[model samples]
Target chain A: MPRTSDGRERLIEAGVELFSQRPYGSIGVAELCTRAGVNKGSFYYFFASKEALALAVIDRHWTWQKGVWAGILDGSGSLLDRLRGLFDATAQMQVDAVTGTGWVAGCLFGNLALEVSSQNEPVRLRLQEIFDEQIAMIASRLASAVESGELQSVADVDGAAKAIVAQLEGLVLFAKVFNDPSQLDALWQNSLALLGLAPARA
Target chain B: MPRTSDGRERLIEAGVELFSQRPYGSIGVAELCTRAGVNKGSFYYFFASKEALALAVIDRHWTWQKGVWAGILDGSGSLLDRLRGLFDATAQMQVDAVTGTGWVAGCLFGNLALEVSSQNEPVRLRLQEIFDEQIAMIASRLASAVESGELQSVADVDGAAKAIVAQLEGLVLFAKVFNDPSQLDALWQNSLALLGLAPARA
Candidate 1:
């Protein structure tokens, strides 16, 4: 639904679903074509190869995810509240994957990051930029929180953001490996500790 | 050097090198056989499938790494000193990988965990047990530290250990993606924060 243009959109959509559900190397171009209802010739017409289609899929998913994160990070409530909202939404996505796919699909960028970063330079660079942006997103929020005098200034807001993002990916790994979404329940508290804050009273 | 036999040891060593250098799905039996200098016939005699060899490789790496960790952890100055020793040794491995192999070979279990958790149940379960063991190893250290009053008792020792492991994995992911081991430099400070302590000064 995000990138639907006759054949091209279909290929991207198929890539997203398949790539998220399993390792990128395990999913073949044939299966992607079949799932998209497009033949090999048409698949070639739209994209050069599976890796090309994969790059497109990464862009498409990041586009959608960035928006979702933006909505939550910019939404109502305090900075901590908004951060928790983002974590909740992330955990919910994994939960939904389990409900719909019978397995924890994990974070798409992270799954690809581990699976293809060394093998594919183009994807690896793109993912690096994406991660930088992800850290920046949170870093920007922390800057705002500091400006407003919400609390004491963090010693290094960017470092805090980077640490927080790393924590997110780390816990996501646990969730995927353990096949349990609740593994992410620690994100909110761990994040507060990283920011040098006490856990919020319930 | 570990689990050394005739063809079997060769295959496991090959698995460690190849699997670390590239994505698991991209590597195949033929190449593995070629690298190990073992023919296809003998390869089957040693392991039933590629996944089987992967399991052997996972066990072998953990066995070796467990010793490295136990040595530093059990022989160090204080609990904090031992923990820092472990983190330093972990980072040094990445640096050594870059020096020896020209790429950061990440934690083998983590690489395999994300690459094959959904497709392979055996590896998933084994990785789950390995992660639990890792968390437990740190929790035991924290418990001893608490008993000595070196620090106040952590509110949740297990939870703190889990968070620290998650942080390590997360930063390792960053180091791998960014292709820079310095991404892990924050591990010590961030880890201290996770354990509800301020950063240790020089």
Candidate 2:
């Protein structure tokens, strides 16, 4: 009885919810269909396989996350302020997940990146691209910070960006494992340190 | 028949191998038993469940890893030198795994922390303790580094230790996802930055 196109969207929503909540290997297509209120026929009608649906969920998540990152990173004050804004938002999402779902939904990409990267090549390739973009975004901002005189200069700007992003993923793991968002409180100071800037300025 | 205790060790070995190679949810007791060359009866005799076997595997892995960490960190030259030693060993393990298994076997605790931390309570608690001990070990080293005048002082020794560990975990995630041990090359410089020290000495 649902709209024809609703099936595809619902499948992705279910994929996001289920994948984020548990390991990717544990989630089944039948369960995905049930959660989406789409029958098996409709499920197959949209996605060639569960992997296809997972790729869709991944694309959808990146699209939304990319928008949020662009909005904050683009509309920001100083580079530190904008980066702080991004970290604040990142921490808040974990808090929100705990409040809403009673579980800290860790970084969906990072979670999948670890869970499926070795077993699933398509998923792994997509995740690699996603992480690369994340690093590039931060690297671009750091370059601007140096140009604007907020930073003296960065040696190996891309490496710094990768380190910052790596730190974020690591803290997010702690947040998920410890079930504590405050674990992320160090992001601002640590980000400053990585950039060779004093936190007194932050 | 094999030695009476070999079954237990074999099961734990299989857990380490299979669990690291794929998501935990997809690996079942039967697969573990077959891989260990232990029959079904012997498996239940050794482990109450797959999760139980996983915990045993975790303990064994930590036992070996903690020894390596303590051996490097507890001995050697400056804090920077020891930390570099630890990072090099960590990267080398991934390299070895790639050479032997054609896949990076990321930190077992970290991989499971993200995968089963929410779903399995006992495993979650054990992992929490392991990570806390890891943080504690590094914090103790940083404290000694300060006492010995390696640097002026550390503002938040524990926080810095946690950040360094987090950065390590983040970079490990990259190493696993990107399938490159070189991703961890940032550990030494980034650890210095986190500690409010310069990397020129590193």
Evaluate residue A130 in candidate 2 and report its C-alpha lDDT on the 0 to 100 scale: 97
Candidate 1 runs further than 4 Å off: A1-4, A199-202, B1-4, B199-202
Clashes of 1: 0
Give the per-residue lDDT of model 2 (tens digit) for A108-163: 99999888888898998999999999999988988888788887647677888898
User: Candidate 1: global Cα-lDDT?
Assistant: 0.88
Clashing pairs in model 2? none
Clashes counted in candidate 2 amount to 0
DockQ of each: 0.52, 0.55
Error of 1 at A119 (Å): 0.7
Clashes of each: 0, 0
TM-score for chain B in model 2: 0.95
lDDT of 1 by residue, A1-202 (tens): 2333688988899999999999999999999989998888888888888989999999999999999999999999899999999999999999999999878998889988888888888988999999999999999998898888874637688889998999999999999899999999999988888888852111
Which residue pairs show backbone clashes in model 1? none
Candidate that would win on TM-score: 2
The runs of at least 3 residues in candidate 2 whose Cα sits more than 4 Å from the true structure, single-residue gaps closed, are: A1-3, A199-202, B1-3, B199-202
